[model samples]
Target: MGANDIFGVPGDYNLQFLDHITHRQDLKWTGNANELNASYMADGYAREKGFAAFVTTFGVGELSAINGLAGSIAEHVPVLEIVGAPTNNVQNNGSLVHHTFGDHKFDRFEKAHRQLGIKSARLDGEHAIDQINDVAQYIYETKKPAYIILPTNLVEMEVNKSLKDSIPNLFFNKEMNSENSFEQIKSSINNIENPVIVMGHEVDRFNVFNDIKSFSSNNNIPVLDLGLGKGNIDESFSNFVGTYNGQISDESVNKYVANADTVVLIGAKLTDSVTGGFTQQFNEQNTIVLNYENANIYGKSVDKDYNFKTIMTYLSKTKLDLSLPSIKNADNVSEIKPSNNKLTQSFYDKAISQFTSADNTIVAEQGTSFFGLASQKLPKGAKFFGQPLWGSIGYAFPAALGNQIANKNRRIVLSTGEGSLQLTIQELGLAFREKLNPVMFVIDNSGYTVERVIHGMNEPYNDVPNLNYKLMPKAFGAKEDEYDFIEASTENELFDAIFKAKEEKDKLVLIQVNMEMKDVPEQLAKTAKAFADQNK
Candidate 1:
C-alpha cells in the first residue's frame, strides 16, 4: 500500500500504505482528528492537481463545510468529489437514524457529483469491501476524486485478497474516422488572411501548453485567451492580445476577430463568459474550434475532434503553403490601457507596481472589480485567476487561499468586491489556520456594483451589512505578527499599503480601498442591459 493506497476512510487502513505509493507525496490529508479536516485533506489533494474538489454530506456539522466546498470548487478550483455516507448498521437495524431521508447513506455525494462531470461510486456491505481497492485504483489513475462509504463496522476491516486483486484496469483505445474534417478546416484557413488562434483550458488539460507555444511560434499565429484561460500561455508572447471579456470594452481584438476569415480556437469553450454570452461579434462560419472532446470546422459543431495532439501533429506535417506573416508580425499591436477612472487605475497601478513579480498570482472576483482589475496590465509570468464563468462573488478569497496552498512560494493578491467578499469571508479563518499568505484588496463601494450596473438605480436591493474590510485578517484570528491591515481612501494611501504588503512576505494583509459605484465598463454595461431586457 502506498499514498494512493490509503483510501475509503482515513482510519479504514493503516498509514503504512502511505509510504509505499510512489506519488503519495502529493496527496493532501485532512487528518482523522475530525471529519472536516479529513474532507479538506481530500479537497486539498484534488485542488493541487488542478482538478475540482467536491463534498456533500447528510451529517450535520459536515454539511456546512460541504456547502462551502462546492462554490469554492466551482469558482477558484474545479475539483471532482462525492461524500455522503451514514453507517449502514443504523439503517439495517430499522432505527430512526439521522440520514435516513434518502435511499443510500451517500446519496448527496452522488447528486452533487452528477452536477459536475465527476464520476462517483459507493462503499457498502461486506461484498462492497471487494470493490474499495478497485475504487482507490480508479481515483489514483484517473486523477478524479471519489467519496466512499465507511460503515462503523467496516472501518476496522482488514485488507483482503479480494480488495488487493480489485486494482482497477485502465485501457486506451483510439479509432480514427478518416472521413476528413481537416479539409474543411484547411479551406477555412486558406481563405482567411489574418487568422487568430484563441487558446483555452483544453490546451492545459491535454498537457499541450508546450505544444501550443511551439505551434504558435512556428505558425506565427496571434493568440487570444478566453475567460479562465489567462494562464494557459505566456502573457509576454508577441502575438498575444488582451483577455476577451464583457468587462473589456476594447474593440481591437474584436475587430481582428470580426475581420479574420479564419479563427482557430484551440481548447476554448464558447460559453457566455468567453463570448460575453455570445453577444460579442464572431464569424462562426469561418471559425475552427479545436478541442479535446469536440471540434468545430467552418462553424459546424462536430461531436468529437481527432485528438488535440493528433490534429496538431497532422498540421505540423502538412506542407500547406500559407503566408500570413503580416498577421503574425503586425507592427502595431493594441496595448491594454487602464480605464479612464483615475482612482481605480491608481489603486490597481499601486498594487501592480508594488507586487509585480513572476511569482505573484492575482485572484479577481466577478463584479466591478473584475472590470477594474482586468484593465490593469500584469507583469510577465504573473497569472490571474477568476470566476468569470459562474460570475459568483466571494470566490476569490477562498480560491486565492487554495492557489496559495498549491504554490506557497508565490505571493497572491486578491482583488475582490465588497458584496462578494461576504460570501466566503468565513474561509479567511481557514487561510489563517493553514497560515496561507494571501493579501486581500477589497474594492469597497458599499453595495453590489455589478448588479446595479446591469439594472441601474433600482439595484434590486442588492446590499449587505457593512464590514470592517481592513480588519478582516485580525477578525479571522491573525496575530499582530501574522497580519497587516491597511485602509486606502486616497491614491497615496492605497499605493503605500500595496507597497508595504508586497514587501512583507510573512504576513497576510487586507487592503481596503474606498470606491464609488461609478464608471462601469461600457461593454459590461451593455451586456447588463441586454441581460435585463431579455428577462423582461
Candidate 2:
C-alpha cells in the first residue's frame, strides 16, 4: 500500500495502461531492461518500503516476472504485480492475442501463477475495485505477492464520486486483539532459567522489528537470528548473539541456543539452506514458535493464523521469570589483517566487514556475498537482505537499484559474485540513467565458485566466460566524473578501495576483488557439504 514508485517494462497490450500510470503525479515509473529485472527491483523496493508494485503485459510479460514474484512468495515479501491483459472482448470471445499461443487460452498465465501460491484475479470494469481490495487485503495479511490483471478497457474507467471515498478506507482494520488473538504462555515458561530468542525473515516482512527488539531488551534475553533476515534487528544491542544456522553457526552461539531451557523462535524458517540441510535439531517441548500462520507454545499449539506485530505485542507484555545463563554476545566480523599477499577468501570477508557501516544499505547476493557475510555484524541502523530460499542468481544487483530508488538518502552498497552479476549487469546502465550512485564489490573469481563448492570443483558447466568487470561503468555510459573503478587483488589494495569509496560520496565505485575460483568461506563449504550429503 505504500509503493510510491513502480518498476516495469512496456509492451503493446500495456502501452495504453502505461499512459495513465505515467500521468499519475504520485508515482514514478522506472522502465527496466527486462521484466525479470523489473520484478527483481520491485522485490528490492518492497524489502525497503514494506510494499512494492510492478507492471507487465498479459502473457509474455507476466511470465517473465513470475520468478521474481515467486521469490516474494517464498520470502514473505508483499509485492503487487499489475498485469495488462488483452481486452475483455478478446477474453470473452476466446480470440488469440499477439502475446498468446495460437490456441487462444488467455487464462494460462494466471493458472500458472496459482501454482506458486499467490492470489490472482483477472479484473473486469464492473467489479475491478472490489476485486483489487480483496486481493490487496489478502496480500497484506499473508505478506505475499498478488496479481491484478487489468484489461485495456479499464485503464480510464469512469466512476462516481462515491468510488473516490473508498480510497481513504484502504487500511487493514486492527483492534487490540481482533486480527491476532493470543492466550498467555505464562505458566509454561515461568520455570525457564535460560531463554533465547531466535528471529528470522518474517520480522522484516510484517514490520514488527520495534516490538520484538523492545521485548528482547526489556526481558534481558539473548537474541540469535537466521541468515535470511540479517538486518531486521540491531546487532549492536547488548543482548544480541551471532547468527545461527544449525551447526554452521559460531560454536558459542549454537551452543547457547542448544543449551537454552526455553527457546522463543519468532518467524524463523528452517529451510534446507538456513538449517544446514535439515541438520538443526531443536527440543520442541521447550520451544515457543511464533510464526505467520500459528503459534506453538511449549509443546502446545494454537490454530489461529496470527500476524507478527500483534502476537509480539502480546508476548512483550507478558511477564516471565527468566534467569538467563551467562552468554557471550559478540559480532561475527572477520578481522583479517591487510598484507602484501594476494586476496584470499578470509581477507575478502574481512574487507567486506569493514566496508559496511550504519550508513549503508547492503544487498548481498546468495552465494559468496551472502554466505561470506552471514554472521558479519553490522553497525546499528544498517539494513541487509538476500534471497536465501529462492536462491535466484543475479538478484541483488537490480534489487540494490530498487532499494536506492525507494530510499534515496541511504547509500546503497552491493556485494555480488561475478558470475551472478553477468545475468543482470545491464541494470547498471539503468541505474546510471536514473542518476543513482551505488558502491559495488564485484567478486571476480573467474567462474561459479558456489557451484564448485557444492559438487563440481572443476566441471566445465560451472565455468563462466572471462570478462573485465572494471570497464562496466564506462561501457554502461556512466560519465567520467560519475564513476570510478578499483581493482583489489591484494589485501592492502582491498582496504584501499573501501577507504576510497568512503571518500567519494557522489560517484559510483566499482571494486573488482580478485580471488581464487576454488576458494570459498569456511561456513559456505561446510553448508554445501551438508547439502550434498542430504541430496545423496
Candidate 3:
C-alpha cells in the first residue's frame, strides 16, 4: 500500500489495468521489456522502498516472473504480484482461453503462486476490496510476496470510492515491556565471557539495523556479518570485524567467531554459501539464535513470545562488561601489480573499492562478479545487494534498474559477468527507454568462470558464445550521445574506463572488462576446491 513505484510489462489482458496506472499522475510505471525483468526490478525496488508491486498477464507472463517472486520469498521481501487474467465470465464458464491450457481451470496459476508466495487470492466482485486489504496486510506483516489475480473485466469495477482514498493501518505498535525472553538473553550475556555478535540478511529484512547497531556499539561487541548482510551495518564501525563464512572468511574473522564462547546470531541463516559449504564448527550448544519471532539459546528454544526488535532494544539498554580481547584486524588491500599489463581480479577489486562511495548502491551477479566483489569494503551508507543463496545469474542488471528507479538520487553500480548478463540483457533497452543512468560493468571472461573453477576447467559445456558487449547500447537503440560505452583489456584502459564512467554521471555507462577465463578470486578458488573435493 505504501509502495511508491510500480514495475511491469504491458499485455493484452493487463492493458486496462495499466490504463489506470498510466492515468494517475502521482504514480510512476516502469515498463520493463519482459515480465521476468519486471519482477526482478520490483524485487530490487522492494529492497529499497520496503514495498513494491509488479503486474503481468496471466499464464505466460506470470510464469516468467515466478523465479523472481520465488527469490523475493526466499529473501523475505514484500512484493505484490498482480496478475491480469481473462474476463470473469470466461473464468467462470471455464472457457479455453489463450493464457489458459484449454482445461478451463483458471486456478492453476493461483495454486502455483501459493508455493512461492506467503498469501494469494483471486479478486471477486463482491469481496474484491476485502481481498486486497487482507493480501496487503499479510504482505506487510510477513514481509513476503503476495499474489492477486485481477480479471480483465474487473479493472474498472468499483465497490466504494472510500476504499481507494484510504489504506488500512498495518503498522503494529511496538511492545515496550521487557519479558522473560529479554531476561533470558540478559542472563545469557552475563553468564558468558568472550561473546560475539553475528548478523545476517534478516537484520536488513526486519528493518532492525539501527537497533542492532546500537546494541553492538553499546556493548563493544565485535560484529561479523554473513555474506548477504554486507550493507546492513556500517562497515566503518570500529567494533565491526570482516565478513565471516567459516573457512572462506578472513583468518582473523574465522578465529574470532570460531573461538567465541557464546555466539549471538541474529537474523542469520546458516546457508551453505554463508557457512563455506557447511564448514563452520559452532553448533547450537554455543550459539544463541535470534529470529524474527523466536529465540533459541544453546540448543534450547525460549518458550516465551519474543519480538526481535524488542529484544534488541532491551539489550541496547542493558549493561555488561564486554571487555573481550580485540580481534586482529584484517590486512589492508595489497597493491595490485598486474604482470604484463594484464588486469587481474585483485586490480579490479581495488578499482571497485576505490570507485564505491557512500552514495552508491552496488549489485553483483552470481559467479565471478559475486565472489570477486565479496571482499571489497563498502563505504558507510553504501548498500550492497546480492542473491548468494538463490544464486540466480543476471539478477543484478534488472535489480540495478529497479534500485535506480527507487532511489533516483543514488548511483547504482551493477557488476555482472558477460555470460550471466546475456540471460537478462533485454532489460537494458528498458533502462534506455526510461532514461535511467546506471554504471554497468560486464566481466568478459569467455564463459562460466566460477563453474570452471569448480569443475570442468576446459569443458565445452562451460564455454559461452562471445558477443561484442560494448556495442550493446547501440543495439538496444540508445542514441549515440545518450550513453557511453567502453571496452578495456589492459590495466590502464580499465582504470580510464572507470574514471570516464565516474565523470559521465548523467548518462548510462557500460564498461566491458576482458580477463582470462581461468582468472578467479582467491576466496572463490578455495571454496570451489572445497566443493569439488566434497563432491568427489
Candidate 4:
C-alpha cells in the first residue's frame, strides 16, 4: 500500500489502468520487458522495501508472471498482484477473450493462481472497495502474495470512502497476547548452558533485523546465518560465525554447532538447499524454533502463536550462561592471487569478497554466481539476496533494478551467468533508460556450467550461444557517458574492470568475465557430486 513505484507491462486489457498510472504524479511506473521480469522486480522491491505492487493483464500476462509471484510467496514476500481483466459484460457473457483459451473459461488463470497458494479476489462495482480492503489486510497480516482482479469496467467504479478512516489505527492493529509465550521461552532458555543462534530469512521480512543483532551480541551467542538468510546479520561482528549449511559448512562451524547444548533457530528454513540436502545433524528435541506460524521452545509448545519480533525480544532478555566453552575459528580460505594468468572460479570468489563492502547490496544468480559467493564473508552492513529455494535464474538483474529504486544510496552489485542472463536480457534496457548505476558481472563460461557439474558433461543441452557482450551497452541504447562495458578473460583484465567499475560510480558498468566451461567453484563441485550420486 505504501508503494512509491509500480512495476508492470502494458497489455490491451490493462491500457486503461496504465492511463491512470501515467497521470499519477506521486507514483512512477517501471515498464519492464515482460510480465515475469516485472513480477521479479516487484518481488525484489518488496524484499528491500516493506511492500510492493505489480500490475499485469489477465490470462496471458498473469500466467507469465506466475513463476515470479510463486517465488515471492515461497520466500514470504508481500507483493500485491493487480490483474486487469476484461469488461464485466464480456466476463458475464462467457465470451472467450483473446488471451484466454479457445474455450469459454474466464476463471482459469485465477484458478492457476490459487494452486500456488495465492489469496485472490475478483472485484465488481458493488464490492470493489470491500475486496480491496480485505485483500490489503490479508497481505499486511501474512507476508505472502495477494491477487486482485480489476475488471475493465470497474476501473472507474465510484464508491463511498471508508468511514473507518476516521477512527484511530491502533484499534485495528493489535498484537497477540504473547505474555505466556514469552514466559515459556524465558523459562526454557534460562536452563541453557551453551546457546547457538541460527539467523533465518523471516527476521528481515518482519523488519526486526537489528533485534537479532542486539539479542546475539548482548547474550554472546555465536550466530550462524543460513544460506536463505545470507547477509541477514553483520558478518564482521565479533560473535558472528560462518554460514551453516549442513555438510557444506566449514569443519569448525559444523563441530561447534554439533557441540552446542541448545540451538536457537529463529526464522530459519532447513530446506534441502539451505541444509545441503538435509544434512544438518541437529535434532528437533534440542532445537528452539521461533517463526510466525511455528514457534516451539525446545520441544515444548507455547500457549499460543507468537511473532518472530516478540519472541526474539523476550528470548534476548532471558538468562543464559554466556561464558560457555570457547568456539574455534574456521581456518582461513586462501585467496587466489590476481597475478594469475587465467581467471578461475576461486579467483572470482575472492574478487567478490574484495568487491563487497557496507555500501553494497549484492544479488547473485542461482547458478555458479550464488554458489561461489554464498560462503564469502560480507562487510558489516552489506545486504545479499538470492533465490535459493526458487532456484530461478535471470532473477538477480531485474531484482537489482527494483532494489536500486528502493534505496538509491546503496550500490547494487549483480552477479549472473550468461545462460541465465539470456532469459531476461531485454530488461537491460530498463536499467539504462532509468539511468541507474549497477555494477553487473555477466559470467561467460560457455554454457550452463552448474548443470554440467551435476550431470551430462559435454552435452549439447547445456551449451549456450556466444555473442560479443561489449556491444550490449550500445544495443540497450545507453549513452556514452552513462555506461561502460569490459570483456575480461584474464586476472589482470578482471581487476581492471573492477577498479574501473568502482571508480566510475555514476556509470552503469557491465563486465563480461570469461572462464573455462569445465571450471566450477569448490562449494559447487562438492554439492554437484552429491547430486550426481543421487541420480546414479
**How well is each residue in 417-479 modelled by candidate 4, as lDDT tens digits?**
999999888888998898899999999998899899998879999998987878888898988
How does model 2 score by TM-score?
Answer: 0.96
Model 1 poorest ten-residue lDDT run: 5-14
What TM-score, to 2 decimals, does candidate 4 have? Answer: 0.95
Clash number for model 2?
A: 0
RMSD value for candidate 4:
2.2
Q: Whose lDDT is higher: candidate 1's or candidate 3's?
A: 3
Each prediction's number of clashing residue pairs: 10, 0, 0, 0
The global C-alpha lDDT for each of the candidates, from Candidate 1 onward, is 0.58, 0.83, 0.83, 0.83
Best by TM-score: 2
lDDT of 3: 0.83
Error of 4 at 213 (Å): 1.9
Report the Cα lDDT for residue 330, model 2. Answer: 50
* lDDT of model 3 at position 162: 70
- Misplaced by over 4 Å in model 2 are 176-181, 281-283, 303-307, 325-336
Q: Candidate 3: worst 10 consecutive residues by lDDT? A: 331-340
lDDT per residue, candidate 3, 1-536, as tens digits?
56767888888999999989988988878788888888888988988888999999999999999998888888778899899989889998999779789997988888888865448889888888889888887877777889999998889886777766567455664565658878878788878888888888888877876776777767677888888767777787777777877778878778778778989999988887667777776888899999875788998887566778778777767667566554455547554544349887768877887778898898988777777776677777788878888877878899888989888899899999988898999988988898888999899898999889889999999888889876888899899888998888888888788889889988999988899889998777877887788889
Candidate 1 versus the native: TM-score?
0.79
User: After aligning candidate 2 to the native by TM-score, how far in Å is the CA of 520 from where it should be?
Assistant: 0.4
**Regions of candidate 1 where Cα sits further than 4 Å from its true position:** 1-48, 52-78, 82-84, 91-95, 100-109, 112-117, 125-152, 160-191, 246-248, 299-305, 312-320, 326-342, 345-355, 375-377, 456-460
Candidate 4's displacement at residue 110, Å, is 1.0
